[model samples]
Target: MSKSAIFTGLVIFIIIALFPFWINFGKTAPVPEPELVGKAKTAKKCVLDKMDMRANHMSLLDEWRDSVVRDANRIYTNTDGKEFAMSLSTGENSCLGCHEDKSKFCDKCHNYASVDPYCWECHTEPKEIK
Candidate 1:
């Protein structure tokens, strides 16, 4: 083949190989962010304050439990990513349902292994309120 013909063929091959990536790049629809309505922050604070005032550890952590449940339900429904590979706890229970009673459940494994969980980073501690 002539030199110009060979060059044109190579250029066409390269474009064809890269076409799929270029076609998919930034092609997804943009996700809409949640709109913050009036008094949303204040309403959340008031609800959390009421939970804190209830004097029960469970009530204090109820917000975190609800958040986890909602996230799990979303994952279960979507099943679009790797979430479909793992198991989710769907029952009406929180991680506290297992971790709080250390002597009974958590201690049996986590205590013996001397491992600390990152859960408390966001979730409330089950111990007496500090």
Candidate 2:
């Protein structure tokens, strides 16, 4: 083929190959942040600060689990030296006491972040009658 025709064909090939990128350029919309639900909205406070809870909740839960099961320590002391029962199932001073609705508080964020926590698999979740 002639030089001009070859050059034009190459340019067309490149444009066609990158057509999808051009079409999608700057079209990305940010993912909508999941909202906190149920009692979490009105709760007096959380076990950890908002930012700490959001970042390290899984690790905290794991520590709680090990403390209760392996170390046989049933009482948890917060930063303020307030003690609470460390039972995950009973929902007394643990996670469920304040955030009673797992579907709302826990599951919403977990699903949004694509994390599948196995805590609910073995532990029976407290049922909300309403």
Candidate 3:
């Protein structure tokens, strides 16, 4: 190949390789961290560790759903042997009690991750009073 053609190809390859880094060079803002909302903020602890919950919350919720709906089980026993009622109506012990504001807590991470969970389709979202 001609020197000029080789140089042009090299330049193009360099630009393509560095384009992504250059585009995001000065973006120092950390990823939006999920904020704990409602009673969760003040709660002693969660059923699972923070990292576990963040990574596997969907699977956990699915398991809970199946246990409650399919198996007709209404109690969840944690690793520590603490039993919690799996009924959605018992908000305090379930999801809504801790995550009182779905918009602030759940929506933040879900929206950031572009995940559209169909949770609200079947379950009623708690109306914010204020």
Candidate No. with top TM-score: 3
TM-score of 1: 0.25
User: What is the full ranking by TM-score, best candidate first?
Assistant: 3, 2, 1
Candidate 2 clashing pairs, residues 3+ apart or interchain: none
lDDT of 3 by residue, 9-73 (tens): 99999999999899989888456666777688888577777788789978988898998789898
TM-score of each: 0.25, 0.66, 0.70
Quick one: best lDDT, which candidate? 3
- Model 2 / residue 48 / CA error / Å: 1.2
Task: Write the residue-wise lDDT of candidate 2 on 1-130 in tens digits.
Answer: 8999999999999999999999989898465454555666676557777898789878887888899889999888889787777766585566776567677667776776788888877887778433
Q: Is candidate 2 or candidate 3 better by lDDT?
A: 3
**For residues 21-126, what per-residue lDDT tens digits would candidate 1 score against the true structure?**
9898988745333232334322332222434533453443454456546665332222222222112122222333223333454335444456565545654545
Error of 2 at 73 (Å): 0.6
Where is the poorest 10-residue window by lDDT in model 2? Answer: 29-38
Candidate 1 differs from the real structure by a C-alpha RMSD in angstroms, to one decimal, of 19.3
- lDDT-wise, the better of 1 and 3 is 3
